[model samples]
Target chain A: MHIATRMKTRTQGGITEVLVLVNHPMDTGLVKSPITHKIIPAHFIKTLTIAINHKPAVITDMGIAVSKDPLIAVKLKGAKSGDLVSVDWIDNEGMTGHAETHVS
Target chain B: MNLPRRTFLKQAFSGTALAVAAGAGLLRPTQALARTWPTWPAQSFHIKHWRDLEHSLFGSKPVVSGGVHLHAPLEAENGAVVPMVISTKLAAPKRLALAVDHNPYALATLVNLTPHALGFFNVRIKMGKTSRVRAYVETADRVHTVDRLVKVTIGGCGG
Candidate 1:
């Protein structure tokens, strides 16, 4: 998979906390050839969608500034152990990446 | 040239000695001490106020800050990538957005929310330079905002 996700869900006092870490280069287009000195056109994720049970939960727009392999943490009050949580991202170059896992 | 003798002596004793040594032709300037220059976008980012940013991004100015907490680092090691999080006590938000006041595009993202958020959200955004990041959230009733300054290291935009 182009995107690998690590996620976990824990329920405590009726609140479910979701932790996410996505693996990607998140290239900010800042690096260029030492010889040519051309700008390394920024290539990074633009949109990130978090959905629970196929319903959109949180949607974020990313900038060229996000670091490689981003981390996201959220707390969902009513989510359970079996609900399906999906994360999807679209890069600036239009390349899309996605991954899904169950809350446990 | 305006440096005091003690300062010059300190630099001469410290790292600037190489630049001094280069002047004497004792050594060639090395890449180890090469300078890295940061470049802001050619077009300047201009916004008169946070309300202006809100008006441009969300159509109307927001209410005073309440119920929303923005978590971010006080200082960022790199300007290109910064970590951000927004948490709130609102029941059901209609949308939320993040903005860096000095970025080429201040409005980073505005997401239509679901009741599922339970008021906590996280994401990472890039900062072209050091600036205040404001998080605005619109619920069924009103809008709330929270902001903080995030300092950046020089030449961090991949100079």
Candidate 2:
């Protein structure tokens, strides 16, 4: 459940968009080892939540079927030019990753 | 006396004509039928993870959103790493996720944003085969999702 993330922002039509990419294997346990012929145990991000300036914004419940290195995009409320946004997530196995970006 | 011979000959000719027509129709439409729309499985799904979202066990749910857009190649040369992008058009967005059908694990990625997030993301993923990629966006009060199909040339995950 090791996680890594990157964030970016852009302005369009007076609104700001935030994009993020996360890295993880997200193994679904259904996959078998190519050589050993054994099924890999299911492991993926289970719960994810987002906050803006310490306010809860979004939360998600996930399972093992999610793809590896999932990417996410979200829009923030009241985000204007020149603001700093913070992003973070935790996986079912308790691994966490965080990133930040400045709005332009 | 001669009536029977003439009648038999007429019937045989008509029957042969019908068979030829049927064979021509099959050849003309076979390729079109091959590209028919995808169908959901018939049985019920007992999905324990995101990867099983397309099976009969996992029911279909409507996803709503106005800001999230998902972009990926319509056809991928490799199943091991297909490039994709998800972008939000909202002024400020709070959450984003990627869901896929026909993959062992369907939920591919999730991201939480702080106040400064502008709502855009990109990455590459291993696809089991051909699949529809779905992007879920969570804003202040609602969740929205958009989907696109990506055909994988090679099976990812050693499928």
Candidate 3:
């Protein structure tokens, strides 16, 4: 129910690179619980949006095939060092996570 | 210092460019973002075959073409977490997707890039077995794609 995110940004020349790591089980529904020995329900981020300075730059539609603790990177052409890079994601179960940081 | 460019972007998002796209019915009405963002291609993810996935996502099978690059290991030591990077050489890449031919669900991820962003992405995915991984990029009128074979030593789907 609770998702944690970490974001790092770097700017060189005129491009700003943003990398985000999201905390999630990314269960494939085929994976069985080690304790219960039952197939875990599918739980993964479905829609992830990256915004640069409040303008949506990239949107990712993901599935259970993504690795656990998903790491995503995006590049913005005109984003500068002080621009704000934000990430917002919603999972299949309707849970959401948000994190933002200034590009550095 | 950034106020002028920020103001221009604000104007573009609020009134001119995106609004025109929406007014021209180019943007999907179902998107909750109230902008030109693409709706999740839910059916594409459920497909199991490469041909079907291409059909479901793009309406037809795109010919294997250049300009789209997929960076993945020739042999993935661990199927649980295989790092992949995809980029396009086209001037304007509208949509990009990655699919694994052998996985139960072939579609890995779909990306829609706005005008402000570049056509490059880095992520990791799970593979069921040794399979052909394909990356597709869509331009205004053409869809370019490329694929690579990634051998998984241990399958990742069975837990």
Best by DockQ: 3
Per-residue CA lDDT of model 2 for A1-104, tens digit only, reads: 23567778676876656666677777767778888989987666555444444344444445554447666555555666766665555554556566666777
TM-score, one value per model? 0.70, 0.53, 0.84
Order of candidate numbers by TM-score, starting with the best: 3, 1, 2
Give the Å shift of residue B140 in candidate 3. Answer: 0.6
User: Compared with the true structure, what per-residue lDDT tens digits does model 1 show for residues B1-159?
Assistant: 599999888977877777776766433121111111112222212343555667665565446687788999999887756778888877787677777877655666556566777777777777767889898788766788888999987434553
Candidate 1 lDDT at A25 equals 74
lDDT of 3: 0.85
Better of 1 and 2 by DockQ: 1
After TM-score superposition, the amount by which residue B23's alpha carbon in candidate 1 deviates from its true location, in angstroms, is: 70
Residue A77, model 2, lDDT:
53
What is the per-residue lDDT of model 3 for residues A1-104, given as tens digits with 9 covering 90 to 100? 57798888888899888899998988888888889988899999888899887678999999889999999998889886678888878778877677889977
Docking quality category of candidate 1 according to DockQ thresholds? acceptable
lDDT tens per residue, model 2, B49-112 = 4435422222344346456788899998878678778877765566666767776556665555
User: Mind sharing the TM-score for model 3?
Assistant: 0.84
Better of 2 and 3 by lDDT: 3
Off by over 4 Å in 3: B1-39, B60-62
